[model samples]
Target: MKTQRGDIPRRLDTPDPAIRFYLFHGADEASSRSHATRLLKAFGAAKDAMEGGAIKSDPAKLADEANALSMFGGAKAIWIEPAADEIVAGVEALLEAPGAEHPTIAIAGALRKTSKLLKATEASPHALAHISYAPEGREYENIIEQLCREHGLAPAPGVVSRIAGMTANNRELARQEVEKYALYLGSGESDPVPLEDDVVDRLGAGTGDVAFFGLGDRAMVGDIAAVQEGVDAMSANGSEAITILRAMQRRIVMLAPMQARVAAGEPASAVISSMGRALFWKDKPVVTEMLMRWSAPRLARLGERITDLERRMMFTQLPAKSAIGEELLAVARIAQSARRR
Candidate 1:
């Protein structure tokens, strides 16, 4: 059976007994692995329950391992990550095996639309296939809210959006930020306090992937030196140029509404504080400064430009890294000009 991303959570938590295999593939490898882990937990399977292997190494061994009884006779599961075409025969063997009780999950990287392995898994009566993608807009916000709930947190009005803003392009970073926030909040025995804007500023600061490289913070503040440092770190760390651009795009999206509010004559501080309901407290001063430097009209233009840049990055064969670097430098120049004005 085929499952959509939205339905995967519910299905995993209440896994269908009929589904014996799952094929997870997408550009978002982190989400695929994380979802597979959730499914295993839901099925009362431990980490030890999974037999891990590579598709290129021993596709046939996958079935043998899954079929082989554990010393403790625990529930069986198989995890194959970064899979390739070599594993199709092994997967087929597992599918054809009689009385197979194990649940096998394959987490593959970017697959073609007509992937044979994916098609076969989805077509099977006892299997499921789900494609994970980077969440966008409200989808990521919902994920942030869900993460809060899991940690027994009741987020204050903009907390979810704030967290989502920080981690939109990266799932692994989102998980870590949410976990860190939950830990700060302590256990659920007592009535948990609603997450506050200042709390996010203090606790969630510098926790995101880009934040770790100091890119987002510097970009928002118009610090040329910091921006250069961030870009250098990104290249050194092998972060994709498109990924960095997407993060900047998300940052621009977050700024548009706040800029609109500021344009409407609300004090920059107040507008930023309200719209920044989830903004890190320490970062508030910087965001406020940026808001003051640019008018709503200018910010709106930048927003449009960012969208255009992201589209180009996604669609065109324009040297992505170079394009991203030029665009970022343009942004810094705008900030510098705004400062002069």
Candidate 2:
């Protein structure tokens, strides 16, 4: 029997017991589990009727279990962990068979373009969805904003970018950090407060210098003494010059878009909200004012300089101290320029 294929079905039809299967692949265990739970719940009352089980790397058992009938009243759901080629043949067999008996859900840790499992799942009547662990560009920012809104907090200005950079493309890690921050702030506040560097430092211990974001914020606020203190602390913590440069680079990139949006008369609240869900702290107003002071031309110049410094840091073997010092000086100069403006 030829099974239906294309986009995965989001919901199952009732009266007649229809088996619905979903496939999710990703490195982030949290994301995979979250997606699986959502699909399971979407099946309505049938969710309770569904028998749940997991399939290992073996394919024969996977096929047999998927083809088996449900014990109770409703459909059966089978989640295959780390779907690999060895299991693809069995999965394909199950897909090819008439799926009148049960529903199957496969959860994979990773997926390749040429995998038979992916192709079969994609082509099968079962629903197929993917969850990536990698934080792609603005998606991380979007997630942070959503989380903030859910927690009834506002993310301080530049917080999203700072958090995003610190996590270094790890969404699950970023999510954990955000959750910790929210917890620290407590859930009772009616208005959002600015998250302090100490909070972030406590959450992201031993990864790198926490003062990077604090310094960036101080620079944004045109606080020379605070910025200098942050730099000094960062240096003392054994942070490399290139790392500092990279942090500065990330800040400039985050600020450029924000400054542009703000200059066009966009509401600060709307601008920050659009960036992501993280609650903006009290310092948002200060950050907003800093954005207004920088102007587009100056921001552009800073970006260009940061990019050049980043290239040198990546390609050359210059002393870490000298390289970092130059970047710091550049940041200080830009802050001065913004203050003057």
The numbered model that scores best in TM-score is 1
Q: In lDDT terms, which candidate is top?
A: 1
Q: Give the per-residue Cα lDDT of candidate 2 at 107.
A: 66
TM-score of 2: 0.48
Off by over 4 Å in 2: 1-19, 26-34, 37-58, 63-77, 97-104, 107-110, 129-133, 188-198, 205-252, 255-341
The lDDT, on a scale of 0 to 1, for candidate 2 is 0.58
TM-scores, one per candidate: 0.80, 0.48
Candidate 1 worst ten-residue window by lDDT: 47-56
- lDDT to native, each model: 0.70, 0.58
lDDT of 1: 0.70
Clashing pairs in 1: 201-280, 201-281
Instruction: Mark the 10 consecutive residues where model 2 has the least summed lDDT.
Output: 1-10
Q: Kindly list the per-residue Cα lDDT of model 1 for residues 213-319, writing each as its tens digit.
A: 33544665677887676566565333456566566666667677887877777888787657443676656787787787777677778778877876665545577
